[model samples]
Target: MARSYQDVLAGARERIPEIQVSELAELLESEDAPLVIDVREQDEWDEGHIPDARHVPRGFLESRIAGIADELDAPIVINCAGGARSLLAGVSLDEMGFRNVKSLAGGFSRWKQDGHDYTVPSTLTPDQRARYSRHVRIPEVGEEGQLKLLDSKVLLIGAGGLGSPSAYYLAAAGVGTIGLVDDDVVDASNLQRQIIHSNDRVGALKAESARQTIEGLNPDVSVKVHPFRVDQTNVLELMNEYDLVVDGADNFPTRYLLNDAALMTRTPLVHASILRFEGHASVFHPYEGPCYRCLFPEPPPPDMAPACGEAGVLGVLCGVMGSIQANEAIKMLLGMGDTLAGRLLIYDALSMSFNELRIRRDPECPACSDGAKLEFRDYEAWCAGERGHAEAPVSA
Candidate 1:
C-alpha cells in the first residue's frame, strides 16, 4: 500500500522526539552537549547556522552519518531550514539503529527567530575550489585544511637541490607565502638537481629563479625572495618572519645556525640532506622533539662530511628527499598526521631500501637543553673545527 506524504510525516513524528529551540540552546552550553548536525544544503549552510554545528546535507546524511557520529547511543540533534526536514532526518537516523536522535523543533528558522547565536563560515572561491579539488576531497585535508594551508607561510633556506622540489610542491599545494633565501646564482652544474631553475635563467640569482617558478606554478602563493646567505646576523629575524622553515642549506654552518635560531624562535624546522645515493630527513619541532644539534652533538670532522657538490649527489635523490621535507612541512601546517618529529628517515636509493632511527631530545643539548642559554655563535669557524666542542663565545 502506498502511503501519502502526510501519512509518512505522521509516522516519522511518532518515531522521533522533538526538542525546542530554547532547550537545545541550553543543552549546547552544558557539559554534555549533543552533536548538532545541520541537514541543510550548501548554500543554506553558508548563509548561517548554529555555532559549532556540523553540516551534513539531507541527501548525504544517511551515507556520511557514521563518519561523523562515533556511537549509536551518542546523543545527536538533527536540524534543517524548517522543522519538517529535521523530523524526517531523525526518523532515518532511528531506522539506521541510532538510539538517541532528536529533531530540532521548528529547526534553524525557529532558532534564528529566537535570537540565538549563529556562525557564517568562510568558503573557497570557484577557482580555488577547482585548483585544489583533489586536496579538498580528502577527509584530512578538506576545505578547512586547504584554507589553513593557504594561510600558512614557509621559508626555504636554500633554493638549490633540496629547496627546488620543496618549494615547487609547496607552491603547488597553495602555501600562501614562500620565502626563498639564497645568494648564489644558478650554475650549469645545479641544473642536475635544481629543477626550479631553467637553462635560460642559468646566471640568475637562485632565490629569484625559484620565486619565478613558484609564482608561475600557483598565483595563490606569494613568493618573497631574500637574495642573501642566511648567517648568524639575520637567521633569527628570518626565522621569526615565517611560521616554519625548510632547511635546504648544503653546509653544516648554516644548518647549525638554523637549528639554534629555530630553538630561540620556537619554530618548527623541516630538515633534509642528500648526498650521492643517500638522503636523510627529519622534523625538528623546537623543544617538542630532538633538534639538529641533538642528533649531531657537533659537526663531523671536515674530512668525514662532504657537500653534495664535492661528493656528487644523484639528481633524483634531491627530489625524493625534498618531497619528503615538503610533506612533513604540510603536515605540520595542517596539524595533521604524525610527522617525523622524533625519528630520522634514511633513504638509500642504491640499496633500494629505507630505514628509520628514533631520535630523542638531548637533556644536555647545547642548543635546546633545559637550562642552556642560547645565542648566536661563530658557526662557520665552529663547523670548521677552528673552535672547541664547547659552545663558542657569542659572536657580535
Candidate 2:
C-alpha cells in the first residue's frame, strides 16, 4: 500500500490539511460550497462513494488541476476510501500553493454509509446567444471588462425592482463572483421592470434564477445564490467580502442596515433609489468620505414617500440607473476616475435631464462621527424617528 500521506511525507503534515465529513458538509451548507475531490485510486471509486464528488485519481491530480484553475478560491476537500489518500492529495494540492485545501477525514465510504444527497453531472442546453453579444462588442467594455466581470464578486440584497437592474448590469458586466440574496420567488408582475428575470423564472427562487440568468448571459461569471433576506446579524459578514455595497432597497430598514454595516467595515457604499421617472445615486464611505447619515441624518416617515410599486416607475429607468451604478463600480475597481463621492446624481427620465448635487457633511452625524460612542441600535427604530446624527470628518 502507498503509505498514508502523513506517513509518506512526515514533513507534508506541515503542508497538507485533513478535514472531517461533517466539516466538509457544513462548509457546503454555508454560503459557499467547497469542491469535493475524490483522490482515491480509480479502483476505489468504482465501488460505492459520495455524491457530487469529482474523480481525480491520486496519480494525476497535480497535473490535471490546471483545468480547474478558476475554482481555486473555492474550498477544496479531498477524500479516498478511508482518510489516508485524501491527506496525500491535500499535500500535493497544497505544495502547489492552493490557498484553501483539506482532506476528508472519514472519506467516501463513510459518507456513503451516512447517506448524503449527490448527483452525477448532466448536460444542459446552451444559453441564447444575444444575451451577452452587445456587451462584448462595446469598445470601452471589451473582452477585458468581460473577463474582469467574470472575476468580480458582488452580493445583491433583493430581487425586487431595484435588485432587478443591479442584477442585470452586474451579470452583463461579467463580475467574476456574483451572489444574490433574496427569499421571494419571481412573479409575473415583476416582468414590467425586473428584466434580469423573466416569466419563466416566476415561481422559482429569485436568487436561483438570478444565478441562472447570469450563467445564461455569461457563464464566465460565477454565481452564489443565497435564498434568504439579510438581517443585522448577517449583514456585516456578507458585505465584508465585497468591494462595494449597492443599496437598491425600497425599505429604510435594509438600507440602514447596509449603511451601518458598511461604515463598520469601511466599505464604499453606492446608494440608488428610483421612483416614478426619477433616480438618485451617491457614494458613501465613512472612513474615506462623508456617509449617508452625514447628509440625511434620519429616514423620512414611513408614509411620507410612496414606494415604486405604489408611486409607479418607468421600466427603462432601471436599465439607465443600473448601468450607471455598474459604471461606478468599474471606476472603483480600476482606480482610474472620480466617483460620485460626497455628491448625489439625480436623473429624470421623463425630461431626460440630469442634476448633480453636492451634499454636505454634518458635524453632528451619529453613524460616521466621533461625537459619541452609541451602541449599535436597532435599524427600524433608529430610522423611524427624525433624530439628527453628527459627522466625524469628511475626506475627499
Candidate 1 lDDT, 192-266, residue by residue in tens: 889999999989999998888888889999999999998877888888989999999999989988998899899
Considering summed lDDT, which 10 consecutive residues are worst modelled in model 1? 387-396
What RMSD, rounded to one decimal, does every model reach? 2.3, 14.1
lDDT of each: 0.91, 0.71
- Among these predictions, the greatest lDDT belongs to 1
C-alpha displacement of 396 in model 1, angstroms? 5.1
Model 2 clash count equals 18
Q: What's the lDDT of the predicted structure labeled candidate 1?
A: 0.91
Model 2 misplaced regions, further than 4 Å: 1-149, 372-375, 384-396
